[model samples]
Target: MFEISDTQKIGVGLAGFGIFFLFLGMLLLFDKSLLALGNILFISGLACVIGLERTFRFFFQRHKVKASISFFGGIIIVLTGWPLVGMLFEMYGFVLLFSGFFPVAINFLRRVPVLGTFLNLPGISGVLDKLSGDSDRTRV
Candidate 1:
């Protein structure tokens, strides 16, 4: 059992991680429902992931066709796997949603040519690479 003793969250990824832990810690501290808070945050994160991915692809891509196709494909993957986790292990659906959704979306963002390359400025590249693990040479 890993304990979150220190609350000093200092890093570029602080916003992303700190919020989750803050809520989790509070839940533990107050003896409140933790899985519920975790569930809500994860679900909200999943929705944000979908919205961000679609919006970025829509504005950046030449046409809507590709984005629609990709979005539907992502939907299929997330939806199909969700039920299986429930049946197999009483899993949290949002866990499947966020963990599966974010990686592909971030990878897609890093692959976008001009926009992605623009985002690769200095510290940002390291952040993106670390978040998505995309090693495509074009990004560098």
Candidate 2:
């Protein structure tokens, strides 16, 4: 079985709170302070969960350099009181950074009962497929 350390557990909680704050910030029309807090919490949580060295390695990898710049730049922008633009930059960086995992995530989601059914719908499935970069594959 896999073991999660106490620090990682705390990290998970912090990351969850970060995500909640991020959502709330958006709900409140992109409040700068909440977004900044979320960014700080999320980054710290990630470092705690994975270790500072690993986090640094992950972000600074050659192929991920641009993504790292965009993601951190977005955080800086948010801290400077440009929440909307910062969020947009972050979104782009996030998508570029995580696109490779989309197919795996989509496939996993397709197995969850209610969500699976909803995802299998024509329009939804098509959009998911496109986003996952699986649109070129012929489904059996």
Candidate 3:
């Protein structure tokens, strides 16, 4: 069985709430306040979950400097107004930061009952394959 510490549990809750607020903010036409709150919560939660040192290491890694700058810059922009533009920058940063994990995420999603069925559809499957960089692998 896997064990989770108290701080990590709290971190998960904070991260979930952050995601919820982000969705709500977008739904409400990108409210700056909610988006900013979500950003803070998400970053703090990440630090809590991974430990502050690890979080710092992850963001400050040599290759990730640009992405970290973009992501943090977007947060600053959002705080200064211009939610939509800030979100665009954040999206770019997020994609760059997480691109390496896409393949693992895609493979995990492919195992979920409902999502797996939907993703297995010809068109969607092809797209997922390309996104995950699995296009070169033979598909059964």
Candidate 4:
């Protein structure tokens, strides 16, 4: 009894292809730069593979601001791959992308020693709240 939805099948295929290209680019490609392009493909494909409900939870829940930035960063990375900026974007995007899903880490990260200082900096929380659509309070 193996019945899978069309979307799930598509997701599995995209994820598989992404992983294959990633390995191929890293292990077989003549040019090392194809690795970055492969990474971009991998991230975008993974994004597409994730379901809307989980994606929404990741992007709009505890780490909405971080998730949004990472998703957009992934786009920018893909666009700028040829220009060499995509590599940097991909690295940063991956970090935030994963962080967006692990709710426990969000608060933990905010409480780290040096990192906490930066996280607590003025105006950041307000902007984050606004991005998350939390309208409990008014800002002047």
Name the top TM-score candidate: 3
Candidate 3 C-alpha lDDT tens digits along 13-90 = 898888888889889999999999999999889988999999999999999999999999998999999999999899
Give one digit per residue, the lDDT tens place, for model 4 in 11-70: 677667766765675466323455555655555555566776675666666645764676
Alpha-carbon TM-score of each model against the true structure: 0.27, 0.91, 0.95, 0.44
RMSD of 1: 14.0
Off by over 4 Å in 2: 136-140
Best by lDDT: 3
lDDT of 3: 0.91
- Separately for all candidates shown, the number of backbone clashes (residues 3 or more apart, or on different chains) is 0, 0, 0, 0
From the highest TM-score down, the ranking of the candidates is 3, 2, 4, 1
Q: How close is candidate 4 to the true structure, as a TM-score?
A: 0.44
Q: Output the lDDT of residue 80, model 2.
A: 92
Tens digits of per-residue lDDT for model 1 on 1-140?
A: 85432322222133354357435644565222333334334434434544556645543455444444443443343345442222222223323334446668876876689877766787887676666655564642
- Measured with C-alpha atoms, the lDDT of residue 21 in candidate 4 is 64
* Candidate 1 overall lDDT versus native: 0.46
* lDDT-better candidate, 1 vs 2: 2
lDDT string for model 2 (13-53, tens) is 88888988899999999999999999889888998899999
Query: Candidate 2 versus the native: TM-score?
Result: 0.91
Clash pairs detected, candidate 2 = none
